[model samples]
Target: MTKPKRFHPFYIVVEFFNVIKYWVIPLALSLVKDELSFSWWQYGMFAILFCLFVFDIIRWRMETYTLTGKTIHVNEGVFTRKVKSIPFSKIQNCNQRTPFLYKVVGVTQLKLDTGMDGDDDTITFHVITIAEARRIQQLIQTKSDSLETKEQQEVEPSVITKEERTLHFSPTAKDLFRASFTSLSMFVVIPILLSLYSKLDELKEIVPIQWVEDQAQSFIVQQTWIMMIVLLIIMVCISFVVGIIRTFLKYGKYEVSSDKTHVYIIQGLLNESSFSIEKKRVQAIVIKQPFLKRLFRIAEVKLISAGGIDHSEAKDDINSLFPFLPRKDAEAMISTILPEYQVISTMHSLPRRSLWYKLSIPSYSWILSTAIIAGLVIWVPALQPYTWLLYGVSAFILLLSVLRKILAYGNTQYVMNGSYIQMKHGGFGTELFLTKRTKVIDVSVERGPIQKWFDLATIVTSNRGKPVLHRFRLSGVPIPLADTFFTWYRERDQEISIVNEDQKK
Candidate 1:
């Protein structure tokens, strides 16, 4: 057992950033200070920051953690202390997050996931040295291994040997290039550009935003076609650069491998990050393709594990197993990681009545909108002259909506084989959800009045997750298929329960 210890001395900087989040109002106030009438508001904001800083100092002094052989204990709060004791056996994931700033400070934040639905039950070390975080992770994993060994020895006295080998994968240069082109992460540049533009006041000397805007407007007025071409070229260049940077930061030298009991993921460039999860902790698998990625025949595979923490904009994105792989390669990778749940694409097609069920709402809404638009043009004398244009736009919108519904209906599928369940959905691109029968926490079959008349239903399966209930839905499924799926789930769950019991023995 290690003695209870305080965080690294440099961790106060990270604590400062925590309090800085509360300084947003003050920051905004400072930006508009010259325009404001009351000057005392600035002083008041300073007072607030000062108080928060003092509060964090006290909280930092009060917080302490200890790692014993079997558990990690955390004590929090300044006056009213709250203690959390997390057993190693309950831990599903030990993930380390190194924000860009944290990397500069040489510290990491450790998150301990316990297959729970809320953060209240999880334990976190907000700031610790990278070395200390890794040591703690190793200790917890060691304790878990010991505990499992003890249980196994108790269950069966006979000696048993299991094969132990490491299966490893690292992205090739070609893979990286493909992933960069296929990544949706370039969309991050939109927000980055917007943020910079918003703070143009701060960058007036460096950027000369007003001058640039004037130049662009003058060019557009003088040489419209040339200006458009130049703008398009600049946009493409910026997007390409941003995509390369994002890809390198995310997948550069990426390595994902699994040992006997744990899956390890390592990636990132400047702020290197690593994460590991027990094989048993994985709840579900999702294979996805964006419309553009699908055109390139690239797919992404992600493992849904229990983590109470939400994926906020500021947090690092979940690193999928393979960010961009050929569709066949992605399936082969899934088989390597989870052999039991083989990828099956031969799904039962829904009846033509299902199409009616899918398009019913959108079709009706389009009709109602068109009717209202036509009525306005016909009754309003002033708008009567532009009736043709209104009709043309309304018809286009109706056609687009109907086409989307048809595509989505045609792609949707539901399949249950043995202990595995899969649901495919989406319109332009497809999303395939795969999970074991034991992973499903709830099953729901919904039928509206219209769906009932058409003998169609929507089947939803909920799996374990945090904050949001992870749901996979198969809409416009035949009523019989829905019933069959529900029955299969019930039967498979029971069978899995028996098998689990046998494994325990």
Candidate 2:
């Protein structure tokens, strides 16, 4: 019999860092001990506590390191050993994240995600070399492929059907730059400039006011043409630098590919990361383009996967598949990648009732701005002019909101085909989502007083983590249509359950 090849010893640098992190509080306390006049016993107790905590982390790391052929087993505990073995077949995605320090040491952290469990169940292995991590990933993929092949053979031919498909690749450099230029970054400059203006008084304290006045005078009078040329050159250089850095960080060596069953995405500059999401595990898809991006014809595509971090704080429930893409090409690619989904047509005009709602007493923007202005007027008399200007601005904003609400009101539609639900929605750039009906966890309907009076309802559909709210003005459609939608969604779930039961038999 041939002997199995042995790999190099697993590096424990990350484990060492984990151990040392526990001493940070004690070390800080020791630094302040002389000033605070701490007792010897207290010092000794702190040291002992730090040591215990450090040991506990080391023990946890040791238990967590695991390897397997068909699965990777991670067992962690200080007191109770909790073992989790995630099968290779269950792994829906894997990603590598490396911090600057890890990059210096040529190491990367691997995160393995199995769609079967929530974000907490995912495993992370830190301080592994990039080459070794890649090797492990490839091995897992191979094992998964073999298992799938075996399972296919064992199942009856009539029971299973293969869905063969090709995938769209990532965009090129030009495409990335075009998309990124239209990103929030472009509009972000205005806020940054305003912040600089707000802090000008503080900045004047750091530099002599006389020096700035002297420079301004010289630029305006003595060297006007020369200063203008220099400023223009500087601005051009800054813009170029910004564009290059943004592209390098976001789309550096971006690649997207797929087999019949999964979509793979690999990207990054300093630290390469990759994600493989099985088709069936995707919960939803969202495509959005801010007003600025719309002008440049660019869109961002996001995927709401069954597994990954929960971004409840930011109210972002989806993760980006392609962070940036040209609007026209992205729409084309979606159709090719997920042909079953149909992009819904966004409304060009709002119902009269929706228009009235926007112009009514309960306008959120008006109420918020009024509160802010009131607080500013009460606290800072010197800022009263600014407050008055803000109040005037709020009136304009309220008008704009009413106009936008009229223009942007629309209903998202979802089509049912067997076990799959195809969803679509967009204001600027269209998005199409296809998810198994069985994956939906909940459904809800909400109405505010204004919406109730206007005969409007906001329908929310949830999967595992959070729900996607679709605001539909009921005045535009017959009441029966909403009932039809609710019925379709409920029946779809029932149909999926029956299908699963039949498959079991």
Candidate 3:
């Protein structure tokens, strides 16, 4: 007897939904054009024809993905069927995303990523059961292990078991409160309130005009102290609500675990997500405590992986693995998880040459402020009282620009023993990044005409996806030394690449 062909049940349903969704948008637009006295024919033709073409194109290109014992095979294309086979050994990471809608349909989306491409170079299988996905992942890993020789296999464990580790420190109510209070949501509220205020006239048409007018008159007559108190209470309430929602969305049920080779993160409230970071793939570790968060001694940790996170899904991935932790605990955790990088103690200072480069040179802010002041003086005489204020502000800005240059001077330090480099500078919200030497893709020393006179150079290091540019005024270091450092960084990166290649072999 022949074996029955197995089919992915959920993918079929997803494709059906996709076809309906394609039509729904055009149908809605057609209705809108008929009701309004607009160019109906143009919109009708574009919407219907465009959607039809998209539907046919997508349907034709859609492929069926199957995970076998040794590799993943994807068969796709319309006029000509194309098949792509990737050996399990080349698979770098597997991610699972379950949306609220997906959960209802008992399916999850699985994305397979490799080291060779950007985050978008992922093969997704929609509408697969979580258990089935895990099973497929294990099978791939097992096949990948079989490719290794006996001696190499013996050096490391054949398989890593998934077990939950008890966290020594869990977030308490106080911790949650501190995190929420320090959140960027506080700043976001001001913009929302301003938008509402601007639309007050329009809102009055919908609301009772008499009631709004009475409230406006009362607001004008209210005592300053009473109004101040009321505003304070309102802001506090808003902050509390924002904090609670941010906490619940970001940190709810967050878990961290590690095996010999990977750090795993499982977190979410409504929709759960799981990701594993291989020790070898990490490029840099950034620990940031914004000005507000510093008051509560809380920091956010980010691991810049080879390809990093997908830009399209940044909001979803921002809270993924990038956990909010106490500053002290985050420091200790980094020491353990990434022993290759060290956190060094150093004072923030800019190179001496930075002073000349910053103050003497023109910046975008200076040009913008000047233009605005010029426009106001020429056109809006009503803003004449603000003229004196602008002059004082410009003077203060000039002083700051000079001070900023002085403060930015610093010695670039590379912690060679741990294979990490640290560059410190002077500025508001100054940061220290610890990145692996091997992860540095390219290093260049750049100097423009302005920098040439001041004897300043900007050192830029390119990782996989984008480059991190660090500007340093030469201060006292000889240009020859800076060139040597650039060469050394490049050489180190090449050496690490060869080593990783050999290990793979």
Candidate 4:
């Protein structure tokens, strides 16, 4: 452990794949830049890739990582020779991601983050053996434990002692089947096929969309409605099968467990990933139940940590715990893993006056839709015959806008206990945001003109988010309740030094 160690040689393959993945768009453009013919541009890209690959090998040879008792030292760079020394305590979260290829190569990627908002806050080991990764992480934990002061531990007495892990949640075959639909995994294929189709404009001779459309029309007329229904059923069947495969690949082999101090999650059938985060480091728990998920009685639960949860891909992210868990199961899982977080079931809705004030607000969407539709009808002579469709679209847009606002008014609610505050808000989807009062970094009460007229206000609470601040807004709350919300936040312990608006009070 005292000697510097070179990264696993297999990392070159990982770097190679990353180069191809990140440079795919540029590579694709080179092939089709001037009407789909290979040119010198492709050769230039190949030369660049070759140089990068050589540099990757050189970088692997030059870089070395050493795990000392107090700190981790990484010496990198060929010409500049940059060096980094990070203390054990500075590591906020450590993650192990084993993509399918990495698993085959007997190596995994390691990421140690400081949980701060900066580029330099993270150290990554692109490839390392499993044993090495665990040893490094264990050394960090042992050192961090030795450094914690007794008085600091006493002040935060909730910290649990080390204990063996206990499994809590895992999906079954039936669960996976249900998740395939509720997870909206079937929709993943649509965007992918559409992107490929968009890029295949040059292959119109091989696969003519116009010819396909004409054939579909002819089939519908010749075979009657029964055949058309059968075609739709077949398409739906294919999507369902695809959804099942996607869900199985992502969560078929998932597990959620907890030890004394940390919650552990492992998922993926092919590309296995394992994550560990201290229970105390969990800033918030986000429970989302979209319209379809609600109908299916399922929810997606994600633990928000200061280390920055990857919101971009829930299924691909290690932060997600068996996504598409049954609603009740999700609640129980949170209680089991992080008991400090409260799952509030009941909350108060906004005052009735708020709804009227919301509806009275001018519909700018209607005006914008009308202007655009009218402009199109005037500019396009062919569309002049079907101006009625433009009006219909405008009306539909207005209806959608109005309906969402109404849903928002209905769905908005908030409830606060001594230590936790829960807010429910969103249109067309239900988002249950629950976080401890001490975890909230910022709180602001806003009053708009409409809110003033209706004696209502908006209360926004901010929390730590991945590379950004996550804010939750509860609009159309009664002014009195807004004050209560503000007061509750102000009461956060003296140790939690926060700027306040005491003078305004």
Q: Give the best candidate by lDDT.
A: 4
In order of lDDT, best first, we have 4, 1, 3, 2
RMSD of 2: 7.2
Worst 10 residues of 1 by lDDT: 308-317
* lDDT per residue as tens, model 2, 263-289: 677676665566666665566666666
lDDT per residue as tens, model 4, 213-234: 6897787789977877898888
**Candidate 3 minimal-lDDT segment of 10 residues:** 466-475
The predicted structure with the larger lDDT, 2 or 3, is 3
TM-score for each prediction? 0.84, 0.70, 0.75, 0.83
The lDDT per prediction is 0.78, 0.60, 0.62, 0.81
lDDT at position 104, candidate 3: 80
Q: Give the higher-lDDT candidate: 1 or 3.
A: 1
Per-residue CA lDDT of candidate 3, range 213-317, in tens? 789779877758788788789997886687577676666656666655566676666787766656666777776656556556667776766444565654556
- Model 4 gets an lDDT of 0.81
Candidate 3 residues lying further than 4 Å off, grouped into runs, are: 1-62, 77-82, 118-120, 140-149, 152-170, 186-232, 294-297, 318-323, 346-351, 410-415, 466-480, 490-505
lDDT of 3 at 23: 66
TM-score of 2: 0.70
The number of residue pairs in model 3 that clash at the backbone is: 8
Q: How many angstroms is residue 405 displaced in model 2 relative to the true structure, after the best TM-score fit?
A: 1.2
